[model samples]
Target: MIEILSPSRVDRARRTGALVGDILQTLRRRTEVGTNLLTLDRWTKELIEEAGATSCYVDYAPSFGRGPFGHHLCTGVNDAVLHGRPRDQVLADGDLLSLDLAVTLDGVAADAAISFVVGEARPAESVALVEVTERALAAGIAAAQPGARTGDISAAIGAVLTGAGYRVNTEFGGHGIGSTMHQDPHVANTGRPGRGYPLRPGLLLALEPWVMADTDQLVTDADGWTLRSATGCRTAHSEHTVAITEDGPEVLTLPRAA
Candidate 1:
């Protein structure tokens, strides 16, 4: 469903976005070599409960994923990219890590993701992967304005990834998000501009740009949820929930001082 949020709901969305951003930032700060994926999940749950917010993922049951995600956070390590179900894996120095999270507060929801290198070692390839995805996410957000088409956002993101020599995957990308974590108007990572759903004021979209270092193919892990690179190449993902407004696009999921 494509939802144009009410003004009051948009206000609530800001709160929800802030909560999601803050939690991700907090987790990033706490993460280090030896940190377990399951530990991150536990931290997410505690943070969500402390904020009096509900997790958008814990009980999420989507057709593509194993029913009931049963985890509050997605921790993707190295080659693992999307739908990364938290597990017992421990992060190592120089390992690329991606964290995707969503939550609802006051009846509104927000979603966002971030990728970075773990510990003190910053492998050049890992750093580049994270940086490119972040730039793509910024481009996507910049393209999201009132009257702009979703394809414009996709094209903007695609340019960055492709230009950086990374392969984009369209199977799982961004989407309309409001009261729920995922909604209509699927936003692919790459597409021709001037196509797809038209943007308008009050509409919310979660624009994510993700890429694999070598190939566009993906392979699901044995867990039936985590999506990894088919070629075992490192991957990175970046995302944010944006709201269309008269002033252009407002990034609701930007990190703020806590």
Candidate 2:
């Protein structure tokens, strides 16, 4: 389903987005070498509950996943990319970590993700991967304007990643998000501009750009949820929920102070 947030609801979406962004930022600050993935999940759950917000993932049962996610945050380590279910693994120095989160507050929902290197050691490759995805995400957001097609956003993201010498995966990308976490008008990471759903004022889209260092194929972990790189290459992902407005595109998921 494609949803467009009403003016009043868009206001609520700002709050929801701020909560999601703040939680992710807080988690990033708290993460360090030796931190367990499970610990991050617990921390996220506590923060979400404290904010009086509901998790969009804990009870999520999508066809691609085994059943209820049963986790508050997705913890992707190194080669792991999407749908990363938090486990007992401890993060090591230089470990590349990705955290994806979504939540609803006051009947509105927002989603976002961030990738970073753990500890003081930052591998050059990991830094490059994270930087490229962040740039790609910015491109995608810059393309999200009223009357612009979804493909424009996809193409903008794709251009940046491909130019950076990374492989883009279309299996899972961005999507329309509003009252729910995932919605229609599937936004692939790479596509031809001037195609797909047309953008309109009030439309909300979660534009994510993710890339694998080597291959485009993905392998699901034994947990039946976490998606990892088929070639065991490090990966990175960046995302944000944006709202189309009469003026242009407004990023709802910026840090509260932003």
Q: Which residue pairs clash in candidate 1?
A: none
Score candidate 1 by lDDT. Answer: 0.93
Candidate-wise lDDT, in order? 0.93, 0.94
Q: Candidates' TM-scores?
A: 0.98, 0.98
Q: What are the runs in model 2 whose C-alpha is more than 4 Å off?
A: none
Listed per model in order, the count of residue pairs whose N, CA or C atoms clash below 3 Å is 0, 0
* lDDT (C-alpha) at residue 156 in model 2: 96
Q: Model 1 reaches what TM-score against the true structure?
A: 0.98
Candidate 2's TM-score: 0.98
- Cα shift from native, residue 109, model 2 (Å): 1.0
